[model samples]
Target: MDHATPRVKATLSDEGQRLFDLFRRPQGRSRPRPGERAAMEGARWGRLTVGDTAVVTYRWGDGARPVLLVHGWESRASRYAKVVTRLLELGYSPLAFDAPGHGESAGDSTTLIEYRDAIVQLHEAHGPFEAVVAHSFGVTASFLALRDGVRARRVVAISSVPDFGYVVDAFCARTGLTPRLRDELRHRIERNLYPGEADLWTRFSVLTGAADPRPPLLLVHDEDDEVVGPEQARRIAAAYGERARTLTTRRFGHRRILGSPPLVAAVGDFVSTGAVSGGLPGAEAAR
Candidate 1:
């Protein structure tokens, strides 16, 4: 438990209101650091509205093969700057956006359903993508979208979160939430956020969300990823069998994997492998 857990436990009320509030909102938004800013340069900027929230969107190239870039929780789209550059070199158009409640988006809190909606809308507006490149929580949101009918030829998941329950469990474990409070939080999630969807935890999972005969997947995870364990990738690959591939690395941890040159090159190469070259036919429509 961190310093706040004992105090929170002592002050807990009947409703477990404080715990619910903390669960609902991310601690903070991620911004581009000085060294990361250059990767964000020269992109067309636009806004996408997800339920009254204005999500910030960016497009990096006009290559015919559109590849969607999805960043993890507490991360901004610009964090994929290096990957974006690599995609551009391979003649693949890269599109990305800040999800509701994160980065430049207009919200302080968001849910998986909201993230799925944003992604599906983007695909409807600009896609039929060649592939999807997602990191951490983005893997979950993207998988949910794919299950909900957003189509992509291939998927690259970096530091993947295997399921929704894992997220809750990890959070509770990290914060040292009491067992009673954790149960209450789970009940509140089901009752408030997803009424009538009793199987949401399973349905929203990256492992099970993409049903059988699923799209080809590339699972990348660092052995030392403290945030999301490396074993998550092994489980996904095992489930998908031959449809999925793995790239295991060391020392990169959760976030640094996005910036690794060799890894980004491999991802770009994987995404562009048989993708045809040229400007996207409906490129102008996205405007």
Candidate 2:
């Protein structure tokens, strides 16, 4: 039986349905500030039309080995300024895009499928990316894109959720939605957003989809992460077996973990060496 099938059996009131819809839609879309824009002034910028929205992309450096940077929910490509600068210094081309509904991209809200399609479009136009550095929700979309055949030699999943269900659960908890309403919300999401895919949560889950012989993965999580717990990283690492390596940090939290000097250096070292080294401060194995 489908995981959401039992939940959908419960009836929901109109008010509950509306509340669920509101919770599903992303809020607080991030727009680049003057300083952020100025920081990216030297990069070449372009846009790709994905369905009804335009995804804004920025390219830094002229290296043949392209690396993709994916920002998390409610964030923009410019958020990875430090990482992009580091990648450039390491002789790798770093390409980042503002997802639809975030930053300069079009749309008021976007879903995981939309994010996946945007990644695919970018890959088709500017790919085969040597690696992808994805943060939070972007990790889910990036993994889905990889499963759908977006080529990448390696992946760095930073502050990632192991399952899409975690997002729905977090939403319900934050909104105080009743169990029936939560079920109805899942029903509506399945019907409206992912109608063609009956098992979206399972299919989109990195923990479930990651298998043997897949691209090498570097799972990075902060011990003090408030948005997504560090255990999510452990789950993903365990799922990928020997192909996956994890780096655990302290006090960096979720958003700040992206730009942490230690985290950035770890990513650079992983990409450059193709093997994770031991004795790095604040780093630990997943197992």
Candidate 3:
């Protein structure tokens, strides 16, 4: 593929293909919790440097085992507000942060590396964490970090792309890009990696290191989610063997999974025990 790099360069030279490019800067900033706001009539924010980029964010919760709440693509950490409150109420400390180029983080563009490093660093600062509750794109970086050797007791992937190649192909199909750009995208993945990465594709998947199973995982997905397919969630469960458990819901769309009572209960149960709650659609699940 070294010979293919020149053509890859030419393919990405198109300045007009905006859809192929990811959003470089963060969109929404976080707001303080209702209690925090009510108490002080103010909000707080902070920053941490991962690698060279500064990730601006916030932290909250109160429990023996800390939980990291990671938000999805084009979304802020504040979206997991319910998860934070629920975990906190349950006596678990939940730390939420903005991925570079997603929330209030300081960066024009972000990459999977930055996100993974941020999680690792945060875990180091406020660990040893019990689990990481990640959504969408956060799942990608979480997989990379956990697979690459970030210590965690558990990982919860919500609405994640099971395969990076699949997500790329889906985006390529949606944007109507030529197959040639796919090769260039592969080149970008190559660039995204260190000089010695043996396989770019496996390097991006959590499944690579998941087989050994250092930490158990619970994958929650919405069957009707138009964003990330349910197949991804199933693939994740299958990869983890008995260590991974999944619960699918038809009603909650992509964003609602975090706030849904059933999902929250299932996550709570899964974290406490390895068993996953079988809460079918329209069933009465706990809040």
Candidate 4:
């Protein structure tokens, strides 16, 4: 609970001009934790310009068969070091980036539209991708980009956020915003975040769309996830039906699941061969 929440709740009805600013901005950027520095070694680092913002990018191994790795909110590309290592071993190039306001990127705040635009630009440079691997909020951006015509042979969504409303609801719950303030925040996000998109809520959702023969999607989630919850994966699995394969794990929760050795290998296998090599421990597959 940073100082923003209480202050916003206190002054929201008065000097509430920047009420949604904290919502748009991540509270803090993530860094490579100890023993995580090696995960980023031997990568070609560069920057992609999206609407005048410099987004730091990473590419591992030869740029042959490219797979996009999208990290969640308050996370960075280095978070995928283990997966990157596995992908390289499996002969798939892993491409990742620090979304505008996260990691070593240039911005104080960012939006789903910004994330989608960055993905589209990356696709223009290194797509149609072999596969897409995303976590949490990144899953939302990936879905929006796919809806907007980004192509990939397969997708891996870990602890996915199913829609924009879930994001808002979760934030309000965590920040303890008043009901009145929460409703106002939602309206402000709709009107100001990406203006003129009246259908932003429906269009950005994974639950409302049609079954249009999307790429084979692999959905991984923790049964005990404390951040995004297991229902998000269930909803996506139900919506995608036969097109989506789900794997449920325990103990790893939300973030640690990213670096789980078994999970990383599963992702690599799914990306390269379109299947998991060995059945994961405590894994449950949903139809």
Candidate 5:
């Protein structure tokens, strides 16, 4: 049952429904602060036009091996600062881009399709990435890109949502939208945001057959993650069978997992050597 069902049932109205839609749309985008901007000033920066949006990209190191860093929703490329540094130390170049509607990109709203387009555009421009390291919602977009033929030797998904339905469920729970209103919202999203695609959710899901021929995947999730539960990671690992490995952390939670030294090392090791060793004590290996 949705936690917000009671509140939504009590306050159901046309205006409330509209507000819920607006709330579901991506917002609260963060820009690089002075320190972050200064830190990234030395990196090569540019923009690529995808459809009607301009995505800002950053490049660090000049190594032949290129790694793509995909940040989550409401986040920018700079969020991968520590990971980029580690990758550079491992003799691999790191490239990252701000998705449209976030960071330096131009747009107020974006969808998974846009995210996939941006990834494809980046691949076309600087690709055949050695590996793609994606976090949170970016993992879904990265998986979709891989499914649609973007080439990457390996992938690291941290704090990932296993399916698109989880996002829908979370939105409904947060907004206290009743099942009826939730259905209406889904219909409106299909009609307005994704008119041409009838099965957007299924198409976007990482666990679905859409993401076939999975790359060597390193699935990392914090046991204490409040945003995306650890079960999502386990489910994804199970879905990928022998092609994936799972790592669980204790105190890292959701966002903090990104900055964990051991996590960073594990990702770097996986990308560079196709193996990860000496992780946190309780880290579980799946297949």
Candidate 6:
């Protein structure tokens, strides 16, 4: 009887579409191919341990107050070359690292907890930081790291999310894991696969401690971002309110948001001063 009856699966079908949307990044037809190769050749690359895991590091610029850029998931630090160059031009030393499992770093899967820990290690290694900039998952990890104990003058969350639950839900959506199976899978991933403890989301509440952290934050996201959505930035802005500053752009989308000049200027100004000074408040386009 059950086999003969057509079951309603619109819920699952919707889930599939959501998954597709979540993974749909911006179409960057003209990204930095030449710049990437040049940066790779021009900059000195090396490895360092952020605790047990080895992270790949890129060095550029020269100043006392270091500006660190942590890349998003599945991306190496080298990809943020444009931002690094801008930071250098702003007169601050720049350091970026490939988090574990990405770029020249060691490991397989990554978790927010591990990412935060890596940032902590990196901060300790080469900081007394003037500022830290991060994108996507790196943004979440940055929040948690700051809340832990890192002391930076300011933060720039490029395409950041405030909630860890959303991050988990995003993963489950992509993997098509039911609540029960998702729980089971999360348990397994945390226990054996990940470099950190189980239940990272729960740990976030305590780890990312802030009753409004002191440093001014610059949050950048795109309205058309199909990956993490602009709502994530809204949530963080709401949490910090005036303490939080934001820039939204059209067409920049997930990754290419870096390519926008206004975005670069915003970051540069933020590094120069705690505020997102110069040009305009919001919306940037790539050239």
TM-score of each model, paired residue for residue: 0.88, 0.90, 0.82, 0.92, 0.89, 0.79
Number of the top-ranking candidate, with TM-score as the measure: 4
lDDT of model 6 at position 151? 79
Report the lDDT tens digits of candidate 3 across residue range 172-204. Answer: 677676777666655665654334567767777
Q: Which ten residues in a row have the lowest lDDT in candidate 2?
A: 6-15
List the pairs of residues colliding in candidate 1.
none
lDDT per prediction? 0.82, 0.82, 0.69, 0.86, 0.82, 0.70
lDDT of 2 by residue, 13-55 (tens): 5666677568656677866656456558878989887778877
lDDT leader? 4
Clashes of each: 0, 0, 6, 0, 0, 0
lDDT of 1 by residue, 1-287 (tens): 69898787667664477778788788898878776687677888889888899999998887478999998888889888888888888888999999888888899988888889888988998889899999998999899999889999999889999988998999899889888888988988899877888599888898784447777787877888999998888888888887777777777789888887546765776697722222322111000
Candidate 2, clashing residue pairs? none
Clashing pairs in 4: none
Clashes of 1: 0
What digit string (tens of lDDT, one per residue) describes model 6 on residues 1-287?
Answer: 67544443555455545543443322122233566766656566767765578777777765467887888876767777777778777778888877766776776545666678777876877877899888887887887788778878888888776666676678788777777555654454455444455556665532244455568788888898988888877777776767778777778888878757768888888778666543564564221
**How do these models rank on TM-score, best leading?**
4, 2, 5, 1, 3, 6
Residues 143-182, candidate 4: write the lDDT tens digits. 9999898999999999999999899899889988878888
TM-score of predicted structure 5: 0.89
Report the lDDT of model 6 for residue 261.
70
RMSD of 4: 4.5
| Predictions: Cα RMSD each | 7.7, 5.0, 5.1, 4.5, 4.8, 6.3
Lowest summed lDDT window (length 10), candidate 4:
10-19
